[model samples]
Target: MLSRLAAPILGIPRPAKRVIVLAVDASLCVLTVWLAYYLRLGEWVKISGEGFWQPQWAVAGSLALALPIFIVNGFYRAIFRYSGLAALMTIIKAVAVYGLLYASIFTAVGLEGVPRTIGLIQPMLLLLTVGASRMLARFWLGGVYQNQLRMATLPRVLIYGAGNAGRQLAAAMANSHEMRVVGFMDDDDRLHGHVLNGLPIYSPADLPSLVSSLHIATVLLAIPSASRYRRNEMIQQMRRAHVEVRTLPSVSELAQGTVSTSDLRELDIDDLLGREPVNPNLLLLGKAIHGKVVLVTGAGGSIGSELCRQILAVGPVELVLVEQSEFALYEIHQELLGRVGEAPVILHPVLASVRDRHLMQDIMRRYRPDTVYHAAAYKHVPLVEHNPVEGIRNNTLGTLVAAEAAAAAGVADFVLISTDKAVRPTNIMGASKRLAEMTLQALSAAGSQTRYSMVRFGNVLGSSGSVVPKFRRQIQDGGPITLTHPEITRYFMTIPEAAQLVIQAGAMAKGGDVFVLDMGSPVKIRDLAVQMIELSGLCLKSPANPDGDIEIRITGLRPGEKLYEELLIGNNPSPTSHPRIMKAHEEFLPWPQLRARLDALETALDATDLDVVEALLTDLVAGFRCESDTPGWNGTATALAANHA
Candidate 1:
């Protein structure tokens, strides 16, 4: 009803609005005068012996005073929708002015029968009526109009935080046509039963009941300042309640000082797990890759592709992608192409092997890439152990060729992607990677132009060969999920995050720097598998419970597998600006000695001398140890033969 009245007041064209404004002001003045008289006289009938209560005299005097005062104050001149602090001030001023005018009129006519006490009630009545009318127009009337226009039929939503962000979110949703707020759920007991924006705050424990009773289909998490662990816990709780969850982005993203619907996003898959924040050095990242022609070898592999993505964001002048696999190369190429858009940076996709010295040199010479991210080494442990000669040839010799090419081409920086297993090595793959790091240290000592470095970390989640994906597949296949050992554990990180840190570490490198990323505490594989199963809404199958959804079977450790991996080779690690990145200080053979060892090792690898290769690698890689007692030459002959052919 108020909305219908406000339409002509607001939308009846400009001239009509002005006319309605005058009428409303005049009507309000008349109402105030009549109210004052009625309160003073007690009835429409004249009060005997009270001259001031006489109808004609009282009515004429009230209008004569109130009308001029209302018009002069411009009390009805402002748009109600645009009314704010200014309008509020104007209302206060107009009421004060009318109060004085009414007092003066009563005084001039002589307060013969008019009681002075009746004048006191006039100001209070005027203030109440004027303030109430505007407040009604501001809140109640707009809502009514919006509802009449079908804007009130929104999905009822419950917010998860009842703090400042939640209250602001509720206000933002006031007129929203797609989402209506039911109330809030917070963990703070102090906030329980408190009302914010007319919505009650309930504890998280009440979520299920509240959701069911309110028919809530959506939940907005307004805890932008909450820690990741807390958010993860809330998400898990919400998921169990079968509520679809969304969240405002970090507080830093709220530039307008309020959370809008556009700022709310679907809960990311990463938020389901309690992942801690990583603080990387932006200066280091920019120093390493910005304005430089950066080359990423094996650019299509999981880690390598992520590296390419991060490097592109860091403002590299050119990104050279070198990979042997056509499909893998194409995938990364297409992805980068889409993200970089029409930026001036050149993207040179070269199909080549790091093992091809001439090809490596030619590409390096042609592009003169300032930084090279060598990530092409073969890394599967058991597969490499079974193909020792091929593994050594690629992982070791491939790194040597690439490093030498970088040196010859005078590249400013060369970063080798090394693995954690390279420390106290047990497998052929680990030994090969250790040898590659040795080769880089040797090359850096001998060269003047290139600064060689290696960034080493552990297993990344969802990478192609990581156990997480394998376990997922096994679970999906409705069978036993394979585990090497119940006690085995590995450090894990999301691939993109690891790669971003890798690039940032690269930017911090000096000559022969070995940067180790802080992979948080290692997780037991069996526990991880079980968590995945539970998260997938299934129970583990066991001998005791044959009818369970999935069975976890132990496959004894593989030939070259380790129960756990270490990050550093020595005790001395220097802290960097980034808390997660550290620089390792370890001994390296002098250039000439390292060069002679590499020469002999290459000859042994070429000749398929498995026994000699094993001995040479053990001698070269300090602290190296072999786990497998199998015969030394078990798989070398076939592997070498295949490589040569």
Candidate 2:
């Protein structure tokens, strides 16, 4: 019945609602004055039965003073249901001023038809009635009182901190109709068993029981300042309780210093990794980039774009972005332009493939870049496996062209962005990258003026075609998360950190140095998928929980996909000055020998000779084994060999 009544009131025109409230306040003002007169006289007072002072005049004077004061103080501008403590304070201030004016006229000075005490009594009564009315309207029209009727049906949640962020989050949720916060789960034992903001604080150890008793469907992590390792522990506990988890952004991201529902996000996969990133060596980071002309090939790609961004931050005099795709070049160019902001760095977007040696050399000579970061290559395993010829031409031969161009241009430092897949390769993409690394080593050994180096690491989270965004999209679509294999694992790093480390690694490079980043630990794909689902407030669908929110479908492994990736092919990697980087003492072919083989490979490529290409790739890249099951890859060498004969 209240909601039914409120529905029409809520639908009423704003002007009409304001008039109704004003009329009500006018009535309240008159009523309070009459009551003040009677209470001061200790009997029913007649307005007409007085000399100069009368109750009738008192009521008139009260309405005249209070109503306009309320209006001038912007009292009627407040919506009743939305009025909070600030609004009430406005009312008190307005009434206080009205009370002082009334006292000055009636008591401090002398009013012919007003009792002096009436001024004080009447304003006090008005404040009470006015404050009460606003409260009643908030309870009725705001549906806050009615919300209590169905509170049990709302989804219950527990905040995993008792800090200021958690308290602010609880307050923010108090106004939300979607979820209800029942308690806080803090690791601090002193905070346990205490009540905060009308919610109980419980130990994380009691989470299982609390979840059962309170029926918590979600757990929000409000400890933004907490370390990644601590957050991982809290999330593990939440997973054990079988509840969904969400987290606030890191302290650095929360510059606004406040928490709201909008600030809550799904638990990041990096949070699951629990690896603290090492601070980059400042000198190393700036040695090759600061005040120098820097060029990055494949600048539109994930790692390449990030490398461009970090290079820009290091105050490069000019940054040249070389990309095959026109759209990608425009995007990074525009983004860098936006970030330029008063900086004197000039941006050049060059749309050309790294395969075109003449074009690359022209661009290099024209720019005369101090450092060149070669990130242009085919890195996706399965895609490159299917299109092996193009993959090899791009990843392997492209490196050779870019390195020679940089050398001819007298580039100071040439960094090749290699990958962990290049170590003990099993796919065309890996084999191609290994060959690229070898090309750099060979070039460095051949004694160019350029200092050539390679930085190799594992998968970066959120790269295009990577599993992170794929899983997120699948979860949002509410369905089965696809997994290549349950047992497959890979190292993960944030793109920014990887790019920063790449720059530092390059800066520390001696000629022919192969720097491998310490990719913390391998994360199982199945476990990662499960964490993503749970963090998104979903349950994994399986035989154990048939009523779960999402199902995990194993599609087996893709062609040439490895069970696990490795960072180092050779044993005993030496540590660098930077903790997270290592220098691998890997062997490679001499420049003269490798040059002859490269020439033969190029000739075979130009002739489209599949047999010689495959034979040469296998012979060139050690530990490269082709999977027999890959379509279009099986028996290529035999067919080509027969055709040649």
Q: Count the backbone clashes (under 3 Å) in each candidate.
A: 1, 0
Most accurate candidate by TM-score: 2
lDDT tens readout by residue for model 2, 378-421: 88888787666788899999999999999999999999999999
lDDT of each structure?
Answer: 0.78, 0.87
Q: Each model's TM-score?
A: 0.64, 0.76
Q: What's the residue-level lDDT of 126 in candidate 1?
A: 65
lDDT of 1 at 562: 89
Model 1, span 529-631: residue lDDT tens: 7765654545778878787788899989998888989888898899988888899887889889988988898898777777778788778898777777444
Q: At residue 357, give the lDDT of candidate 2.
A: 90
Residue-level error in angstroms, candidate 1, position 520: 1.7
Single out the weakest 10-residue window by summed lDDT for candidate 2: 636-645
Candidate 1: count of backbone clashes, pairs at least 3 residues apart or interchain: 1
